[model samples]
Target: MPKKDQGLGPSAETPLPGDDTVVCGVVRHLGGDYLLAKCMDGVDRKVRIPGKLRKRVWINEGDIILVGLWDFSPDKGEVVYKYGRNEINKLIEKGFLSKEFINALSEYL
Candidate 1:
């Protein structure tokens, strides 16, 4: 049988917001359905798992995730995506994240 396509091709990356408002964060704590994430920008944001992804995705503390900052609430955001091991390595290679940050996450796991 032919393999079924899983949607993402070469350009599976979700289009980034032009303003650079989205940033990487580490999940610090889980508050039931919400999360307290410490962003790379040095601020802790209350990150919410949107309804669409809530049931499908399972996030845990210390996992690396992408967050889209809220315009009205500077210290709050939505959890956009979670980075897998390979994706994390690629981000580090691309200079999107620092080696120190990756080291930090590893220590927690």
Candidate 2:
């Protein structure tokens, strides 16, 4: 299979059963390979977009996402949330996010 067409698979990156966990954050940086987001769980976690999953998801910095992961550290958790548009939109429109924040989120989509 072509590298470009290689969709995010089950083998991409899995945060054991206890790394870290949360569901929202601020985009801090868009790295050469992955994204760096400020987790809302009060844990300063630097996220990474797994090799096979980066291009497949519409993940942007500053966008809030529903995360599901294990304990990565005392202040950070590994990411498992990839494509959660509906969830983000609902939270944004429900007054959890500002217009500017939502706009920023769109840039990644």
Predicted model with the maximum lDDT: 1
Compute the lDDT for candidate 1.
0.70
> How high a TM-score does candidate 1 get?
0.75
lDDT of 2: 0.51
- Pick by TM-score: which candidate is best? 1
**Ten-residue segment with the worst summed lDDT in candidate 1?**
8-17
Worst 10 residues of 2 by lDDT: 11-20
lDDT of each: 0.70, 0.51
What is the per-residue lDDT of model 1 for residues 12-100, given as tens digits with 9 covering 90 to 100? 67433235455555656666678887667778678888886676667877777888887899888888777777777777777677778
- How far off is residue 21 in model 2, in Å? 2.5
Q: Model 2 over residues 35-77: C-alpha lDDT tens digits?
A: 5554444454566555445556566666565454444344443
TM-score of 2: 0.48
